[model samples]
Target: LHNMRTIQHLPREKQMQKATETMELYAPLAHRFGLFSIKSELEDLCFKVIDPNSYKFIARKLREKKEAREAFIEEFMDPIDEELGKQGFTFEMKGRPKHIYSIFRKMQRQQKPFEEIYDLFAIRIILEEPHTKEDCWRVYSIITDWYTPIPKRFRDFISVPKANGYQSLHTTVITKKGRKVEVQIRTRHMDDIAEKGVAAHWKYKEGKEGGSETLEKFVHWVRDVLDNPRPDAATEFVKDFQLNLYQDEIYVFTPDGELRTLPQGATPIDFAFDIHSEIGERAIAAKVNGKMAPLRQKLDIGDQVEIITGNKINLNPDWINDVVTHKAKSRIRQYIKQKERQKAEEGREIWEKRAKRANIEISEQDLTRIAQKLKFDSTQDLFYDIGKGSFDVNELYDVVKQFTSKGRIDDKEDEDKPAPVTEEEIQETYINAARSISDDKALVINGELTNVKYSYANCCNPIPGDDVMGFISRTGDVKVHRSNCKNIHHLIQTDGERIVDVSWAKNIDSKFLGAVKVIGEDRVGMINDITDVLSKSLETNMKSINVSSDSGMFEGILTVYVDDIDHLGRIINKLQKVGGVKSVFRYE
Candidate 1:
């Protein structure tokens, strides 16, 4: 694919597509397999096809300065070549040209044009086998001794090969001509691997006893990428492949000093998953370099990491954004999907129970009818919506009634019906219906009343701070209501003696369910921001939160557990300040 991209006579669109494919596949594959030379060539070829003018301009300048560059290289290598000869070191010297892609990158990164880029060419010293390792270092010392080496630009890869298994000694020094030049010293074996990578490893390992295990690991990882079952295989494979190709690897140590390698920008969560599946799932936080760190904290090379786990796994939906590894993302998504399945099953059960209470037997036909009435694509979708609180139970009940009734009602007549009864009126009807049953039970005043059973009116959902009253039903049980409840006057007019003064206990510790309604302009991340605010408040337990949006406008209802009116008010006040919220008020 990479070579195909460089065919200039091909259509520009076809060439670009080939370039993209090469970037998505071959470039990363080359990098992973330790073929730095091939990877650099592939990148430069793609750059040339993508932007021919810039590549031509850069190439032209480098060609124009070819003579001067050769002269500089000769001047830089002369003293080192002579010193190595005097020291009886057998070595081969070569000039390494910097790839156009690398030069282009330097131009962009340093915000400089071609004229400002130093080290466009480098010198490599390849030593013979008899004293390969020692001679490589000896040559490095001789070169640095003859010139002033740049301390920061020095890299001792011979001691620590790169993650891709390229080993060399690299240094940048000022030559006699005051020009900066890069020098790479390595053995013939290392040079072969650095140039041809995994291919060379296999090609040259005929009689070698223990072959490159690092290269073996790289090959295994590539196999895994090919074998994994991804959700969207082509797109996901391309994305992950590109990530592997372009990112640098960071090596961090486990508590036991076992080194773990991860891509640059990988978080501790990725590290934990890389260690073990269970460790990643149950990870609550992390300790990086002996200090507590967030799960999303990016790791650095040589840092020690210790994963912190708890009894329960913290597989939050937000974890997908924090993790960069395919394994972690796959696990988190699977867990979330399983949880959704469970919730949908639970919602189905709730619907079944409601159907039984209404004396309606639900069959597949009934479910299909209800699903159509709700405008849902399928019965499963309807159940899932119910589970997520996006569908109302009362509306579902009405749908069931229509299906079970003796006669089909005319839709136009239903549309023309009078306004629906207020919640207060519905509660009044319930109280009136209970007037015929007589009982001797007294109302419980915050556990003060014994041998008595009472219930709260759903209309008001009154809490500790509200003025309260109790109504004695014919069944003799008491029903509590807010003193200012809309039906209070009617109840007093019909059965004044039934009304009794009621108060919450002075030190009640119980929580009451409160509802708040919010109106806002719909925008991305609004729900996340709202939930973040609610989660931060102490003792705030969200029972249900439902939001609906239409044409950029949104309305939401949040039901929560609160201590009293005051606690509910505090929640409302906090919600009112959230961005995009137009109004936040208690719902009666």
Candidate 2:
């Protein structure tokens, strides 16, 4: 539902986070257990949001060649159809191109254009019950006899099944017409287990002979993935797990003669993590087959690896690039992140002391601007520099004072740029009085602290995310305006005494009015599509949708109740993706 982009109740930030989790963890997990059907669907759905342009390109290319590809597949399978019929083989044949995401990845790996991909097509041949393992081999022999088999392209999983117990005879062969095609031959029972993954495995588990080894391997593989607890961020997790999904495996041994399977090119760090999380974190040195070798050395088949541990945890950040498994990389990154956070906390304490001693109070918005001017991507990074002694705290105190003394922002570039949905930490505590806010609910704070009272100026109607200034009125209430608003600037220069420091409260419990304008080619169902996106995707409530159409062109103003500027921005972005909608922006 979230991937469909219809679960709009989730904020854009949350949606992005969910999409990343699906891409990095869930989809690949499905693939690991041979749930290709579910895996491919999940990939395509998440791909729509993660990289829309690439998804559209692949989908469009597939559609354009659909008819031709179908004809070619029919022509290619005709000979096999007749041969199988003559041999009285009871089989079901299916011809299909690979999934959209797999093809895109293939293009990326091979560094080739979409048109140049030859092995995009595949055929699956499934035989009925009573078909023995020899029958599968006979089918493979028949196919190879018909076409030239590509070396290293054949996998006889029937003989040595995967950890998931997926058994099939896979081969890529060149047809008489000079086209490459992948082929899979399996029995009905094997196909069932392959399609259903763990579910089918257990279904056939009862009274099944010699299934214990395969089940143990399956359990171990799953345990290996769960070795690392979920981390703060998923970037490293995704990078490592993708290798598990596609890369070949190598079998290694421990000192106790226990065999471990790892992704090809996996290092000692990966091996240690596979054995146990403790050994991976406290790993000091490793002996590969009783010989001291660098941890970065790639393990080979049948090599015995012994990891050395110590009392102290010796995790290296540089090891992030050295390990191929997700567990090792995730643990290393978590360590670095935890250390950085500690430094940032220490820096925050230092800043609070300096600010309190100097009698200076700067808004979170102003601090962010100050951080950017000092070439920091985020305020946390700036403070991190301070904590590590790389940056001077007194210098920051001076910067904050300068910003607070300035009545308003004078930089035109800063005012014109859109306020991002950035997360920030404010030194001051905010009051939970959102229900007392006025109709045009712009966030307000820093007005005598506890008895804070403010309303948005109708002229600009600045929302929570927009950089704003508060002007004290004769009525003892603050009137907030966008810092760039001409009304606020005039008052700042003429009666500067009323210009007071104001920033958005950390939380918003009230809704504000925002107007969005969209223009596009007019067509049937276009209005419905736009409305569904606004109302359903983010669960945003609308006051009214005023629209006009002429000469097959559509223009509309979406008047909606939004929590903040960031919420409104999310709505506009979603509107921009509607099929007939070409332009979407906030209408001031």
Candidate 3:
């Protein structure tokens, strides 16, 4: 009933509402089905009522200048028509102009004014008796032979149709009068297929609809995205699915010249996965046009892509960040999860190795308890971190060494390490054990003070995993400095006796503070932009920020937690990339 109201042409407001429905719902549906022509038309129709002035002006001008437009079309068609006629090729010609919405969209994307936009019109040619692949190439030859074709503007969609199964031979040429225009050539069947898309298949008498399972799967996916109950959910899904749907497809061959369709930005990874899931899982690298290319390389039309596979597992977790397609991302994530599971099993082996190396006897149950204390959901997640370089292996060794080295365990008695009698005794004992009595300021490591001790240094606060050294004060208190700190060498030289060995504690939960200074052009919303960059873009929790502006420059000092130097670098790099940010550097 609602669909019928949309087509019945009711009141102006009703028409507007219907168009909106089409834009929000059907346009995306069309895109999901790879029906670019339908999607574009729906967008154009919605824009007509949404912005009536632009629509009216564009339509009125095109019609008001109808004779001129048709004359131009006639001229555009004359040479191609004459050439095809000489070659005894039968075809029909049609002129098409840019709709208002498409022009507006182009204007918005290019950030250009309308007057600068040319080629707001195009022409299409439909050839007959071009059912075979050879016939399509023959048509291509006939068209190129007659006209001075623009190499960049030519598109051979007949061989590689748009995602929606639309096919054509598209080219652009400059007329004798020097007016630039686009020309699209296709067969009558191809034109019909272009217009109605999958619906066009329904129009055919043959069983075209049941022929390809891939096509049926694509259509079903499109309907699923559209039929989702929540409007917002449908809208979100469409945005992702639409990119794949509306893009012009490339027909690339395998090494054996078998054709495959990939979207414009599709890399070799996309191509590999399209071929087979296992093949994609094993893909290590790719060859494009018979030369090695990065997996992220943009594939051109008719460019062959060959994926290189390896027997050894080598899936990079970072591949998840680069893939544009959901399929590729999902597959990479699956591989990462599998790798993580394997790592979790390996973490046990690693822990056992550490125990043997230190001549200590500990079981997996003890590691599990420690892992739970650290709030890890699984021993695998913890071990995966150890395997993936997120967790330091040496720190695990040091921590285990410290705890096990001077244990008062009675070697003759094995009672599974009895628990403390009370919670307070556990806390008190933990605190006393954390601090050394002889130094009263040093934290003992492996039963020795080692030369390093722990105290929060005034210069560049250090964390558990931070590379650091201890500076012993005159009062016998330890002061820790980052190992790279410039003040450390001078302090050690002056007070060598005060220097001690220090390492990050294994189970430390203390937060270390760091600051970033952002300098940018002072403008309205500048502060908001900076705050958004920190909070939203960088995902840093801003405890306190102080901003000062002078001479068209904005400076902000942000205090945020530092997991380590790498985390700090990631935040700084993100801030540096923000618009209008002149510089983002560590303040202190």
Separately for all candidates shown, the number of backbone clashes (residues 3 or more apart, or on different chains) is: 6, 2, 7
Please, what are the lDDT tens digits per residue for candidate 1 over residues 470-497?
7767665567776546565456545554
Clashing pairs in 2: 8-537, 8-538
lDDT of each candidate versus the true structure? 0.74, 0.76, 0.64
lDDT of candidate 1 at residue 371, scale 0 to 100: 82
Q: Write the per-residue lDDT of candidate 3 for residues 534-587, one digit (tens) a residue.
A: 678767777788989899887778888766656777888887777787777556
Which is the leading candidate under TM-score? 1
- Order of all candidates by lDDT, from best down to worst? 2, 1, 3
lDDT of 2 by residue, 200-223 (tens): 766656666355557667887777
Query: What TM-score does candidate 2 reach?
Result: 0.53
Best by lDDT: 2
RMSD of each: 25.9, 16.7, 20.2
| Candidate 3 runs further than 4 Å off | 1-25, 32-37, 49-53, 78-90, 110-112, 128-147, 202-239, 289-298, 311-313, 334-588
Query: Candidate 2: lDDT of 584?
Result: 78
Better of 1 and 2 by lDDT: 2
